[model samples]
Target: MNSRRATIADVAREAGVSPSTASVVFSGKTPVSDATRARVLDAAAALGYTGPDPLAASLRRGRSGIVGVLQRGPLGIAFTDPVQRTTMDGLADAVASVDASLLLLRPVPGGPAGDSGTAPGPATGAATLATVPLDAAVLIGTIPEAAADVAALRARGVPVVVIEGDAGEGVPRIGLDNHDAERCLAEHVRRLGHTDVAIVTLRSELNVTHDRLGGARDVFPDAPAFATLASSIDEGLRVGRQVFAAGRPTAVLAQSDLLAAGVIRAAEEAGLSVPGDVSVAGFDGVPVDGLAPYELTTMVQPAVEKGRAAGAAVVAMLLGEQPASVTFTSVFRAGNTTGPVPESRGVSPR
Candidate 1:
C-alpha cells in the first residue's frame, strides 16, 4: 500500500497546471475556464485527493477552532459531579456559537493539572498549553491551584478563563459568592439555636470548599471540618458516619447537597431524627438523586450561568478583548433538614 498521502502538487502534475492553479481551483478563490476546472477536478478524482488537509487549512486560517476545557482532578471523578457536567454542557453550547469545538482536557492520573497523555510525546507541566492546539482554555473548579497553569497557557498565547476559581490577574474569572452563600446557610442553622456544628469540605483543593468552610466557620468558629474525596452520596455517607462516630454535633454542614443527604442517612442510622435530634445543611442547592420529601437547606448557585460567562469570556479574549472578571451570587434556601436545637437529646454546645 502507498504510505504517502496525495498532495495538491500531485493533482497539479496530472492536470498539467501549477500547484497554485490546482489550489485555486479547489479553493474557488480565482475564476478558471470551464475546461481548466474540469481538468483539475478530473485529476483530483484520479489521484483520490478529497480536499486540502484540515490541519493545513486551520494553519492557514491561524486557528484550530478548538476551545480547551481543563477539568479539576481526574476525568472519571470530575464527570461524576453534576455541577461540573452541567458547566461543561453550557460551555459546549457557547463555543458552538463561534463554530469552535470544545476539547476536554484532564489531568494525567497523577501527573498534574493539564497533563494530558494525548500528545506528540511525554506530557510535561505545560504540555496542555504548549502541545494542544487551543485558541482558548477554560479552567473549571481549579481555583487556588491554577495560577501557574494559567501563566503557562498565557505565555503560549492561549486565552484563559476560569470558572469557580482564580488564576491570577488579567485572567477573566467566573466565580460564585461561595463564602457569603455558605455563611447564609450556616446562619440559618445558627438561628435555629444550633451552635455545635461539623463541616464537611470537599477533598483536595477547591476554592468553593475553602471559601464555603470559611463561611461556615464565620458562624461557628470552633466547628471541626471533614474532607470527602468526591461529591457523591457514598463518600458523604462514609464521612458522615465518621463525623457521627467522632461526636454527634447538633448540626452537620456539608459542602454539597449530596453530602448533606448522606449525612442525613448517617443521622438516621444513629437513631437521630433530622431537625428533631440533629440538623443538617448543604450547599449547591442541586437536587440529590434519591433525596426527597425533605427540601434541602442550601445555597442555590447559578452554576450553568457561571459556565456561560466563562465561555463568553473566552470568546471575548479570543477576539482581543479583555473582559473583566465576573462574580455571581447565590440565594439561600431553608428546608426540613434543620430546626431548633433538639430538646430531647439536649444537644450540648461544643
Candidate 2:
C-alpha cells in the first residue's frame, strides 16, 4: 500500500485550481472567492489534508514559532508552584498572539554551564539552546545556569529575556520589586513588636531569595537565616522543623507561600500556636492549599504579569523592536497568619 501525505499542490489539482490559488484558500493571506474556497475545502476534505504542515510553514518564514524557557528545576515543580505555573500561563497567553509555543529547556548537570540538555554528557551542538531552532529564549529564574547559552544566543543574534533575574545589561528583564517587597513584609513584622525573627529562604543564589532576605535583614539585621533548595512546602517544613527546634523566634519570615505553609505546619506540629506563640509570614502571596483560617501575611508578586512581559519582550525583540525593561511592584497583604510577637517568645527585656 502506497500511503503518502497529501500536499497543497495535490489539493489544488483535485480542486481544478492552480497551486497558488489553492494555497491562498488555505492561508487566507489573500482573498479567494467563496466558490473557489468551497472547492478547495471540499478537495482538502477528500484528500485528508488538514492544512499545510505548521513546521514547514514556519521554516519557510525563517522562524520556528518556539520559545525556549529554561526550566528552573524539575518540570513537575513548574506545574506545582503557583508563581511558576501562573507565569507560564501568562507566557502562553502572550505567545499565542504570535503563534508561538514554549519549550522547557532543562539544565544538564555536569554539563558545561549554559548547556540546556536532559542529562550530563555530549550534547549535540544543535541540541544546545544557542543552536536550537527557537525564535527566542527566556530564562526562568536567573541567568547563571545558562549564562554561556545566553552568550551564544547573543552571538547568534537570538533575542533573550530574563524573568525575575539579571543577565547583565541589554537583556530585556521582567522584574519585580523583590527588595522593596521583602522590606515591606519585614517591616510589618517589626511593627508587630517582633524583634527576634528567623528567615526561611528559597535557594540562596536566586534573585528572589537575595532580595527578600536583604529586605528582611534591612529590618532585622541580626535575624538568623535558613535556606532551602526550592520554594516548596516540604522544604519549608524541613527547615521550619530545624528553625523551631533551635528556639522559637517571635516571628518567622518565609520566602514563598509554599515554604511559609510548611513552616506553619512545623510550628503546629511542634505545639506552637501561630501568631499566639509564634508569628509566621511568607512571600509570593500564592494560595496555600488546605492552609485554612490562616491567610498569610505576604507579598503578592505579579507572577502572571511577569511571564506575559517576558513573552511580549521576546515578540518585540524578534520583530527588531526594542522594548524597555519592565519592573513590577509587589503589594503587601496583611493576612491572618501574623500578629504581634508574644512577650514570652520575644527577646529578654533590658
Candidate 3:
C-alpha cells in the first residue's frame, strides 16, 4: 500500500470491481448494484479511505464547491448577536441538506475596511476572501461597499445574495419589512394615546453613526425624538436614564429590546414606574438581558426564517434558478410595557 492517501483506483481494486463502478458508487452520478455498493463500502472501510478528497474533486470539476459568506467585523462578534447566529444556523441547515459548505469570511486585516490589501498568509483575513476562488458568495448583513466587489464577482459570473442589506445593482436581497415593523410599533404607540414619546434607537448604519434617536425621524416623521446609540442594554440604560432625568415622555419606543430593558432599568433607578410613569416598547422581540417582569411590547420578526430564506436563495442561485426575494412581517405583541396615557395627560399631548 502506498504511504500516500488512497485514491479511487485503490478503492475499485480493493472492492474487486471496475474503477468506473467504484466511481459511480461514490459520485452517485450513476447507479450501481447494491452488492457492488456494499463491497465498495467494505473496501473503503478496510482501506481507511474517506472516499475521494473533496478538494481534489472540486479542483477536477473546476469549482471550489464552497459558498463564501462575506460578513463584516470579527467572526466571534458576528456569531454572538442572537439574530445573526440564528440566521447563520438557518443558513447552515439549508445548505447541509445538500451537503454544501459554509465559509465565513471576515474583514481582511488591512485588506479593505481596516485591514491592508497585502496578503500575509493563507489565513490573513480579507486576503483569504479576496483571493479565494468560490462558486458563489453570500454578502452577509448588506456590505455597503459591495457594489464594486460584487461587480467584480459578477464579472467572474458568480451569483451573489445579500442578507439584511441593500443588494446593490443585480444582487438579490433577503430582509424583513424593517420599515413596516417600525410603522407597526409607531401605530401601536399612537393608539395608546401617547404623542410625546421619546425613542432609544440603534445606529441606522455602521459607517454613518454610533447611535440614533431622532435620526430615525428621517425614516419615521411621526416618531418622537430618538437618542441614537449602539444597540445594547447599556446604551438603552443610558438613554433611559437621560429621558427619565429630563422629564421622560409618556411612552418610549426603543429600537431593540436590549435598549428597552435598559430604559426599564433607568426608570427603576429614577424611581419612575413602568406603565405608571412611562411605558416602553422595543423591537426584535427576542428575550435577552434577563427581561421577564416587564413583558415588552414588541414586533416579533422571524429572524431564523430570514436566515433560512437567505440560505435557500444561495442554493437556488447555485442551481442556476432565479430565486425570488423574501420579505416577512413582524407580529405586534402588546405586553405590559405599553398602556394608555395617564389621566393628567389623558389626551395625546403632541
Angstrom error at residue 94, model 3: 2.7
Model 2, runs deviating above 4 Å: 1-4, 15-48, 112-120, 123-126, 143-145, 347-350
Q: Candidate 1 regions off by >4 Å?
A: 1-52, 108-127, 143-145, 345-350
Cα error, candidate 1, residue 11 (Å): 12
Rate residue 281 of model 2 by lDDT.
89
Better of 1 and 2 by TM-score: 2
lDDT-wise, the better of 2 and 3 is 2
lDDT of 3: 0.73
Model 3 per-residue lDDT tens digits across residues 52-154? 8988888787767777787765676456666667778888888775567788775555444333211334343434445677777777654455555576567
Per residue, candidate 1 scores C-alpha lDDT tens digits across 1-350 of 89688999999999999999999998897999999999999999998999899899889879888998887667765467777777777787777777688887754543433343333233445445447888899887674446656766877888988887777778788989999888888888887778778998887578788889889999999999999998888888899999999998999999998898998888888888887888888888787877877788888888788878888887788778999998999998888888889765454433
Superior candidate under lDDT, 1 versus 2: 2
Q: For model 3, what is the alpha-carbon lDDT of residue 6?
A: 83
Q: Highest lDDT among the candidates is held by which one?
A: 2
- lDDT, residue 251, candidate 2: 89
**C-alpha local distance difference test of each model:** 0.82, 0.85, 0.73
lDDT of 3 at 260: 86
- Model 3, residue 97: distance off in Å is 4.4
